[model samples]
Target: MNTPKVAEHIVNWLKEYATNAKVNGFVVGISGGIDSAVTSTLCAKTGLPTLCVELPIHQAKNQVSRANEHIKQLKNRFDNVSEAEVNLTSTFENFKTVVPSFESTAKLDLALANTRARLRMTTLYYFAGLHGLLVAGTGNKVEDFGVGFFTKYGDGGVDLSPIADLVKSEVYELATYLEVPTSIQKAQPTDGLFGDSRTDEDQIGASYDELEWAMQMKDAGKTVEDFSGRDLEVYKIYTRLNRINQHKMVPIPICKIPNNLK
Candidate 1:
């Protein structure tokens, strides 16, 4: 693909979309990942007011540093780009104290992680409402569709998605074309949700490369057995995740009555 041309097209598209929407500008949450970096850069390219919010809820030191560096770079490159940092650590702690917890030990960790994402979502929307900006989502195609790796109504909640069509690998390509900070471009991908350091692959059971390939196969009407790779386990893991997380990938189902009944 022509990376630069595609990047320029997306940038222009964002500019026009925001203009037509009659909104003030774009508000994006910077996670210091390739997806966020590229998405924020695209917003910056619009030359409109762009607010990059760094909401750290006990975020890792390195992650916070990367986010700061990204904001610095964006501010230097785009005159209209601005930033805000909201530390949600105390808020999250208070939330955990008051909210009732599930008795099942099996699901508590995941629940807490999702809560973190939802908190960030709430922060983004708060800023969006205050500034009359739309929340630009950072999720890519592989995670957003293939495995549904994002937290629903959390990272998944957004007014617009600029990179949802590109897979993880494509996001890296776009990041390179956009000259996203080399450190962020090379850093391992994480959601910055959990207390401990765990890469997305750690939680997803397969690397993004493997997941992208499996997604392609599945889209082509193939199954895990159809994959030619020697590692059967990888294919199994991909297919399992794809099946289980399909709910997150699709629109919520609602009960409907037949027209004949009417």
Candidate 2:
């Protein structure tokens, strides 16, 4: 989809946004995933001082290595790019110890996993404030809006979302055009918050490709039977996810009084 032109547009947009906001630079939390890689690279391309922080809370070794490699590549390619590594494993463990045990291990596990994202968000803002930079979010359209997979006020909190409009497939296309590391481009997408090595699709109950298609069909006002082909269950799963997580994609709802009452 004219990847180069799209990339150029995003880069210019970032630059203009930063200048208009009067921010010094951008701070991106690098997760070693294609989204973060592309987002960080786009920020770096703006020629503003970009700090790519690798905050690993018991992250997989391969993931951490990929993050380092990406930072190295960015530094070599752009003079404005820099890197930082903050290992938060011990901090997460300490925080977990303080929490009261829950009867439901499942609920506890989910809460702990979400805590990791919040921790990373806090770390990003710390650096952002220290350097007078804005936190550049790495979520794409499919994850951020399609299924609402991101944690609210965690990965979803940022000063700007440069790639929030691009779908997962489009993100991959841009990654390829940006010449992102082959290993990163080939790696499966994960939230890195589980502490385990489970891929995002494994937890999401549907592949990103399927979800993207469902999102498009829904946006076009198509029914499940219209595009389900063979597996009607896939459409059901996608719709359920979208319905439940819809809150994450929009602003907080507030009760409003009528003008006549006022």
Candidate 3:
């Protein structure tokens, strides 16, 4: 079955990579989201030391609790696992001071969203450097590969992504198999930005259900010859994300080394 095989591959990859890389452990951010929770569990299952960071800005107290619960689960499984919390409220405020126009412009919304994401990545990298650990990414296939729901140079930058090929719904299945807490299992997924003013689904204009269906249809060599108005709209949204976020999904351009052999 896909479940057992995927789990085995994850365990094998993490252990072998850690030993081969000579790294002592891994650092992953736990956003109280399913993707991160799954990644953290997979990394911990490898028996390596793991650090889980709770990086919250405008979320409520329950967000912290949920993140801690995920961390606790990881700690219970891995002996060397620990938790850290970093508040970005002050830093976000400081950055706003530099760009006064950011206060009133739409740019502020995106900038803040990006700032939160990058700050978490920065923290994970810090511990990764100090502890000689790799930074594990928490993005799944639907979000990362299909729609690119991560911010560039932020959550998108990581040493490894254990579940980069799994879709959003598939991730839920894995989490259930791994016995992730019920609270986390049922919690609404969000980026925890702007006091939860929106969610990934809200911004995407389609649920993961529809996204997965579309992906499946495409994968199965099927196409909607006659798309309804709603279907056409979803297609446009998906296509737009693919086009606009291409840069985030690719490596930075580098100088080409040309060889002219006569």
Candidate 4:
């Protein structure tokens, strides 16, 4: 891809969308991941006020540091860039206290992890409402469309998605072009929702590269019979996730009323 041209295109598109919507600018949740870094940078390039909000709920140190580093780098590079950090650890704890307790299980862990994302989503919108900015999403093609790896109505809830068309590799390419902090560019991709060191690869059981290849194969009408060994394993993983998470990829289901009944 023509990195410079693509970057400029996204910047112009973001500016146009914001102007058309009559919003002041964009507000993005900085997760110290490649997607968010590239996305926030693109918003900054539009010369509109881009607010980067950090909502950490028991987040790991490395993730926090990388987020701070990126925000600092962005501010130095773009005058329109601004930041806010909201620590939601206490709020999360309070939420858990009110909810009924359950024995720790993988299901419980997953639910709580999703809660963290929803809280962050709420916080981003709060800032967006206060500042008259749109909530910019930080999801990419593989994670957003291929695997459905994000939380629904959580990180998946957004006013706009600037990089959802790009794969993880392309997002990294943009990150390099945008001069995002080296620490963030090098950090392992994680949701940081679980409040641990588990990487995205660990959770998905496939690297972004492997998932991207599987996604391409699926798009080309490939089937399970196409491979063997680890290739088959990865293919199955991709297909299973794509099948189970269709709800995230598609629009919400709405029951249609029969015209005769109405």
What are the per-model C-alpha RMSD values against the true structure?
A: 1.7, 1.6, 2.3, 0.6
Candidate 3 lDDT, 20-85, residue by residue in tens:
999998888888888888888888888888888887777677777888888887777778778888
- Each prediction's Cα lDDT score? 0.90, 0.91, 0.80, 0.94
Clashing pairs in 2: none
What ranges in model 2 sit over 4 Å off? 227-230, 257-262
Q: Model 2 residue 242 lDDT?
A: 86
Candidate 2 structure quality by residue, lDDT tens digits, 139-210: 999888888899998999999999999999999999999999999999999998887889998998888898
What's the ranking of the predictions by lDDT, best on top?
A: 4, 2, 1, 3
Q: How close is candidate 3 to the true structure, as a TM-score?
A: 0.91
Q: Judged by TM-score relative to the true structure, which candidate is superior, 2 or 3?
A: 2
TM-score to true structure, per model: 0.95, 0.95, 0.91, 0.99
Error of 3 at 68 (Å): 1.5
Model 1 spans > 4 angstroms off = 101-104, 228-230, 258-262
TM-score of 1: 0.95
C-alpha lDDT of residue 42 in model 3: 84
lDDT tens per residue, model 4, 1-262: 9999999999999999999999999999998888889999999999999999999999898888888989998999999999999999999999999999999999999999999999999999999999999999999999899999999999999999999999999999998998988888888899998888999999999999999999999999999899999899999999999999999999989999999999
**After superposition, candidate 3 runs with Cα above 4 Å error:** 219-225, 255-262
lDDT, residue 231, model 2:
47
Error of 1 at 172 (Å): 0.7
The list of candidate 4 runs beyond 4 A from truth reads: none
